[model samples]
Target: MKYLALWFFIIGVVLIVFIQFITSQNVKRLTEGNKRLLAEVAIQNRLRLLQNDVLTVESDIRGVVITDDRTHLSNVNDKIESIRREVSALRTDLRGEHAETYITELDTQVGRKIVFSQAILNAYDSKGKEAGEAVINTGRGKVLRDSIVQAVHQLDSIRQYRLNGIISNIENNGARARFMGVGLAIIACLACVLAFLYVVNKGRQQERMIQMLNESEKRIKEGAFIKEQFLANMSHEIRTPMNAILGFTNLLRRSSLTQQQQQYVDYIYSSSQNLLTLINDILDLSKIEAGMMHIEQTPFSLNGLVSSVQVMFADKAQQKGLQLTINVDPSTHDTLSGDPVRLTQVLINLLSNAIKFTERGFVHFEVRCLSQTDDEVVLQFRIKDSGVGIAPEKRKAIFERFQQAEAETTRKFGGTGLGLAIVKQLVDLQGGTIHVESEVGKGSEFIVRLPFRPIQNHTEAFAAPAEAVLNPVRGMRILVAEDNQMNQQLIRHLMRQWQMDHVMVSTGREAVEALRREPFTAVLMDIQMPEMDGYDATQAIRGELRSDVPIIAMTAHAMTGEKERCLSFGMNDYISKPLKEAELYAILQAYFRTADAQPAPAVVNLQYLRELSLGDTEFENAIVRQFIVQVPEELGLLQEAVQAGNKGQIKSIAHGMKSSVAYLGLTERLSPFLHRMEVEAVSGTDENHFQEDYEEVRRVCEQAVIEARALLSTSA
Candidate 1:
């Protein structure tokens, strides 16, 4: 088609050039014809003047003969000279076969006439009027005059014939030019029509393509909408039953069972947890893509947050016989104001991948303080694993959603590949950064840096005492509205264990009816129900009954804004199932504030001591006793240094306690606390986090003493 258009364009240009050429030829011929005709007209005018001069000369001669007037003969010579000049003009202008002959004859005859006239004038002067009259009467002058006239007429005829020929040639050229110009112009117009038709055809094809694209885009958008709806419904449906499964799994883990049964339950629990993580990651990726995920700046302990992440993968590392170590820098702030939940997710996802990939080597985690100010601190989290490293070519692909190092990676090491993507999103949303360094078949290290506002002058809102188990809401009236029988059973077991006064209902309608009948301290409202949903029931309880009871929303739809949604609809608090027992109790205690439940002791791991002993009981006993003695005393001195604000003493004591903490395998436990103390003392940033870390360390160390004493006595 393009070639065809080019040919058409070339033809149109050629036709236009041809038309211009025809017009130019016509102009050139007409110009030549006009020049020839003008020259011929000049010849005719000269000939006419010559003819008039000839007549005047003859008339002067005859007048001289008749009147004998010499005065008339005075200008006769001038007339003869004029006749000679006209003959010369005819000779110069004439051009044809007979043009020279005619000019010569006319010139000869005019010369003879001029000479004869001169002779007549001479005769009149010399012999008088009678002799001149006799010379004129012989009729010789008349013959000469007639001869000159005849020659002038022959020249006029020759010129007139040449003029007619010039006109005829000009007419022929103009007709030819017109014929060629009109034909070429018609062809040029046809070329234009062809070009126009080609353009119109191409335009229609383009229009059809555009319409087809629009229809395809509409279908794609519809498919995307359907996919989004499917994901929402899928998440809601799976979480509903998975909540019950996880809840009962928790309940099962706490029950006494045989060793093989315990292992099976552990497998079930881990599998369920992995499935839950996948769901959470998928939803997080969805939320991040949809621009619905947000970061929250809430005050939390940085050390406590990472410590939990370290513990999460500790067992997996041990099961694989890998050394798992997590360290926090001494100068890093412990209590910071940031998104604890997001930070937790980022760390867990990274460290979990580290352990999952490391089969026979060590997995390490390190948190270091990169920068600090009076009110803010930047912390760097470095997670390094000696695992099957990433290929250099595929390094960037790992962070994209549903992608990994390669296809083999997803096949061998199972993942949805959304972990890193989610981590990347969370870090970016919170105004932080993350990057990776890896070498194929060697190891990989992921570095993440995040900013947090330091929480100064910490105050504990609630504290669980380390004494005895005591119910916060024993005999308190609590109403439960749940539809799932298994979840209801799980809640029943927990309530029975809490020894709380509670009643359970299967539907929101029944719960509302029960609430209308009597007063309850709190209502645990499940969002999804058969008869009436939790939203409508809460509306009834608030709008119709006009009650101010505390309604804690228990639901399975664990998206980003689930809590806000529940609270927006007149609910007092929010929780999701399968619910954690501690969270539920904490919620109740927040309302009642009457719990004396004992805080669980941090289980002391003597793995390092055992490895150091090499089956020497005495050495083991001595180290345990030494740990029990030195930890408390040094903790006291460290407390004094912190209290006195002595930076040097604080550093000296914290640095000196590392080996002792490691001997009992409590480096993860005491290191961050000591690290925070030394930092606050030296850097002079904030003392609140230092104090909080110290208090936590004191409680843990004190509990360690009791556990160690019990162990030593049992070994004895």
Candidate 2:
């Protein structure tokens, strides 16, 4: 459009110039004609003057008749010469035919008229009687005047014609210029319209693309949320059954079972292990999808890891009558640090897949050292099997989760097909690469290259050995505060198997009451119970009891933060259930060993001391004396609260007493009866409630007296 406008401006300028040129040319021609006309008018005037001069000369010669007229005739002749010179100049200046012819005719007529006038003057001078006749014969002067006027008229007509032509040319050129300008403007408008439409279309396309992107992002977020929820629920569902199976299997191991029963248990255990692995894989997939997966760096022995993998799969390969070989390059480092767990997972998946697909041929694992630096070592792991290989089309597709090379292969191999996918993700996360080379019915080789940094200080990497057998729990009395009947029974049975005595309570209230009345080694506190959860109960026990008793947390929720939350609430240790007997025993042994080393005070009845005592009289005597010194103040508060009839204060004091007595394992002697008293005090059932609690307290005091007497008798 700009270009067109420029062109129109140029054309307009050109037309203006052309108009000026043509007008100038026509004006020049008209000016020349006007000049000619003016010259003709001057010539005519001169001719008239000459004619008058000749007539006057004729009159002087005819009328005066030479008395004394010599000077007058001479003046007349000079005048006649000047007029002829003026007419000659006019004739010399003429150019065009009209002007030339007019000038020539004028000159001829003038000259003839002058001659005729001179003849008349001569006749008047020489023959005075013939002067009139000479004037009549001379018509040339009048004819010359008429010819000059005709030439002036013709010049005016030509000038007018040139002026009209110039004006017409200017009007024609301006019209053409206006037409060109309009055409150019139309073209520019069209171009602008097209540009605007193009821009609008492009903008629409970009806007549509942006809208699509926003929708896609929204859908992705929604899908991710749904996936996270599903994974959480699925993990819960799978882990619940899995916990029961694994927990019961562990329990069964302690029982005196026949070989057949043991085999059955083993089958269940192995199946549970496999199921747990599958669940873990699914959880991993969910983490990956949710962008929550994280990499952890740890030090591990590369040689030991590879050897373990070989040991795990070699037997399986042999069972299938396939040869399996694991070869590590001599140059490979024995110890390299990395995410050993993830690395092992990937390698196991690769090797397992290799073993699974191989029918008769050998499956080989070759570990080669690529390079080494101060911090990082590069290694290549290749698992090659001469077996039914993946087809060319299916090779890449096999890396997608839940997709195998063929459905038939999936059925025969019996896998979730998530292994390779997980392997790929893990390898990539480690900043490594994996590729597969395969041909159908020939073989497949999966190659992995990894970089790992070794631990800087090897001495710091050593971990103490775990004990093979647990220490025995002697006849220690334990307090079990579990609300569920079955769970309470389970704990009771577990404690009995360890030859330990325990007091079972249904609620935090009952537990506190029992703790006040009896002495036990430690408390097994459940985290989730009605009216009071474990956290609140532990806080109460810690605050009211004022004892650093070991409170092991037992809960079903095994979520990530549950353990920390449990410990943060004053639990000495945390265990998730379905509980493992060994884990529970370990916690018990930890607290019990410390408790046994410190004898209870003398306020605890001698009978309760005897139950906890290991035939050590000095130890028993020392603990009884300590208990005797501490229990009075605590018992005094309980008695005061009971007298005041403040149920809350009573419960608090009784709770403290219960924890102290339970820790001394006096539950069988003191807990049940004190618990009954506490139930009456809190229930406020009747005036007899306080009386009954008082009676129970009196009975406990009498038992303590009897136990103290027995102890003194034994010592004597």
Candidate 3:
């Protein structure tokens, strides 16, 4: 469109130049024709003047016959000669044959008249009487006058013709100029229209493109939001079941069990580990999708990594009666820098799949150093298996999430079909490439190429043979603040097997009560409970009692922000339930170690001391003696507060008693009654709730006192 407009402009400009040239030429021709007409008119006027001169001479001659004046005749002769010259010059200037012929005839006639006048003048001079008589008879003067009139009339006719022709040409040229001007105007209008259409069309196209881009952007944002929500929910759902499996397996491990029971426990533990792996894969995939996954560069052993992968698959390959082989190029350095976790994840996925699919032949891995520079080294790792290889058409789709080669393959070889997808994503995240070469029923080989740079300072060496073992929790008093009976029992049994003592309570109220009556090393608080939750209980203990006891929160909800929320609510640590024993033991060990190292004995076990009152009087008195010996001043303050009916002071004393009772395994003895009393004193509640709780706590404390007394007596 623009090209067409440009061509039109160029053509219009050329036509304008041509029109100006033609108009200029026509103007020049008209100006020359007008000049010629004016010159012809002037020559005709001269001829008229010459005729007048000849007539005047004739009249003079006629008059002079009576009065003979020779001087006048000479003057007339000179005038006639001058008129003849003017006529000849005009004839030469008019350069047309017909006009020249007319001028020549007139000039000849004028010459003849001149000659007659001159002859008369000569006759008068030589033989004046006779010559004059002869010329008067001839009548030459009248004839010459008549001829002059005819010549003048002819010149006027010629001038009129020329003038008419000039007028006609002027009219024609004016019409042509008007026509050209109109054509130019039309072309100008067309150019304007074309330019306007081009601009409008361009603007419309740009607007449509912008609209499409906006729509695409909106859809992309929507997709991202949905994906984020899905990942969050999936993380929670996956982790919930995983926690239960791991926690129960750990609990079962501590029990005295038969061989079959141990196998079942092992199976649960292994299955849980597998589930955890799958969850991690899903998380990695989510991170990759969100563009948040990053590689950690550190020094790791390349040879050791390959060796570890081989060893991981060795047992599985041997169980299937297949040979497993590993080959590493000697040229490759043992230590290189890269993200070992992600790299190991990719290799393990490959090797594990190879071992699982290969039934009888062999599984092998090879590591080769492709090239090396000062800063970077390129390496190729290959895992090959003699198994049911993927079909040609299905190979590409295998790298897509949740997609297998076929339904039969998925069924025969059970998998989430996410391994290869995760491996591909991880490989790409590390700026690496992966490819597979295989033929159906022959074998398959998976290759990965990665680049690594060496770390300047390395702190730890790689160890492949070390197994992750759960750290032992020994002689730690744990306060189990759980409402669920089964969960409480499970925690209690697990703690017992680890040689750690625990006080179990049903509610947050009981947890606070136990904390009040005795000193506890740590509190394993459950988040959701009747009356008060772990959050409120921790708040109360931290606020009123001024206790800084470490509280490890346990919750069933494993949402994205739940762990942070638990920690925010005054919990020293958090563990999601169903709980892993390792997590619990670790938290306990961390807080207990720090607490035990403190110089001062921070708190007393008041409830445990109170429990010894129900046994044999003397033994109970001895236990009291030991208690007073340890914290006599604090006991006096407790006694004073109880007598004064100061509910705040009573709650504080009860909190002290709860912690101490838990340490002595007498939580059941005093916690319930102390909790009821604390609640009544703080809120001024009705006596009914308090009376019932106090009676139960009194009975348990009495029994605990009797038992403690007998044990002390026996020791003595």
Candidate 4:
């Protein structure tokens, strides 16, 4: 249809142009003929004027001869001069030889007539009327006058003949012009109709194209949804079996096994860890591609973070007999606000790569403060290694995901090639840049520059609290809510190994029922379960049972927003599946450590708040009190928004509270639910599930308020 419309438009334009071109040519030819006709008429008029002037001169001389008046003689002279001037002017418009001959003959006859008239005038002036009459009667003047008239008459007859031909030609041209005008008018009307049809057809085609685009968009959205679901399912299916393999391997290594058995278990553990790393890298790349990865800026120790990343590679470096050294410039500050985790991750990847490729010599890590001000700090990190350096041509390709500098390098030093890619992404997320200087077979150095907001007037930076000797929560019953059989056994084994009394349930509902029947020191809630999910179960425990027992979220979802989602559902902390022994132990230690040291339980860490207040005890107290006063009202409103189905309002409130939660160092306990609520609110799908989710967040907030007040009272 669109093509047809275009064709119609083209035809209309071509027809109108053709008609105008043809009509203009005809008009031009007719106009040229009319000019020639006008020239002929003008020549004839000049000849008549010359003849009249000659006759007038003759008449004026005769009048002078009769009246014997000098005025008449003067008039005769003026008329003769007028005839001469008219003849000269008319000669320019004359064309062919015949026309020129006629003009020349007329001039000759007029001159003779003028001479005769002048002779008569002179005779009349000197001798009077009888002498002039005698001159006129000689018949010479009459002959000249008759000859001039004959010349004039011949010129007029010829011009009139030409004028008649011009008139007939004009009539013919008029008839043709009328006929063409009618044809052109018809063509113009047809062109207009065609153009109108084209416009209408084009409009319809545009509507069809719009409809097609809408359908394509709908299909694309559906495909994206399917992709998300596939990723989620893949994550669950892969992690479930991996959990059993790593968990049982951990159990086997702990048992009194032979050295050979322990070595085999170690291989299994190592392979599982590698697999998990690969999975995480793939998922991270996916999140980045989806634009869901967010960089967090929080106050952290810059030097401490570097040291920690350095420590991560120390074992591998030592295994390879490589010396690792860290040099920090004296001007570098200790505390800055940035995403320490991402920064550390990038550094770890660089150090690991450096350590992996280097056969000998030391790997040096250097940190320097490039610039500093009261508001911002720019720092540079350089990782230098004695390794098989990359080729100049391959330096850029190395940063691309799943691309290695050389195929041989991949076979020699096995890697997924995603390390540098992730590092680059992480650096960019922090608004930093990474560049490399390398020469093949010599060495390579990776430099990173990051800008961070300074922690102003900060006297001391927060460090991790020293590890205290832990004792199990004796006589305290712990509840584990998990659906996966392997995970259940895994948690059960860990709890038994720690010599703690615990109960395991396969569903969230069973866990909640058990919690109601007996008090537990802590609850481990798995997010996905068959009967009553962890969210609803936690809400039951916190709202219906009114229990404040610390609940930790356990799940296979290690995605970007998963932790926040878990915390928002009243969970005090979160840990991913295929859990590490140390991470599990850490969580247990945090809950159980205070059982022996503190006189009462401490539900919140006040380190962040205390640091923020800059040692002002009054300010800390006021801030805590504000959190206590405002959170309940915010929670109530959040609940109302959820009930009203206002996801935007819910997201806004949750996001606002997230900052306070982080400032107070309550992120582990509060972030999961709040973050999940905020993220889910944007989707605004599954309204019933969202309502349940919000209820869980409200319950967590209410519990958090109670605990925060208790901590504030203790601090006071």
Q: Give TM-scores for every candidate, taking all chains together and pairing residue i with residue i.
A: 0.61, 0.49, 0.53, 0.62
Tell me each candidate's RMSD, in Å, in order. 14.6, 22.5, 21.3, 14.5
- Put down candidate 3 lDDT per residue, 363-421, tens digits, no spaces: 88889988887798899999999998888998899899999877787778778889999
**What TM-score does structure 1 among the candidates reach?**
0.61
Q: Per-residue lDDT for 555-590 in model 1, tens only?
A: 877676777788889997787655776557656643
Indicate the residue-level lDDT of 471 in model 1. 29
Maximum-lDDT candidate: 1
Off by over 4 Å in 2: 1-179, 190-216, 295-324, 330-338, 358-362, 370-378, 386-394, 428-432, 438-443, 451-716
Candidate 4 residue lDDT tens string, 267-375: 9899998898888888878777766688876666565455445535655787789888888896877657777667877888898889988999889999999999888
Separate clash counts for every candidate: 0, 28, 20, 10
Better of 1 and 3 by lDDT: 1
TM-score of 4: 0.62
Each model's lDDT comes to 0.77, 0.65, 0.67, 0.75
Q: How accurate is candidate 3 locally (lDDT)?
A: 0.67
lDDT of 1: 0.77
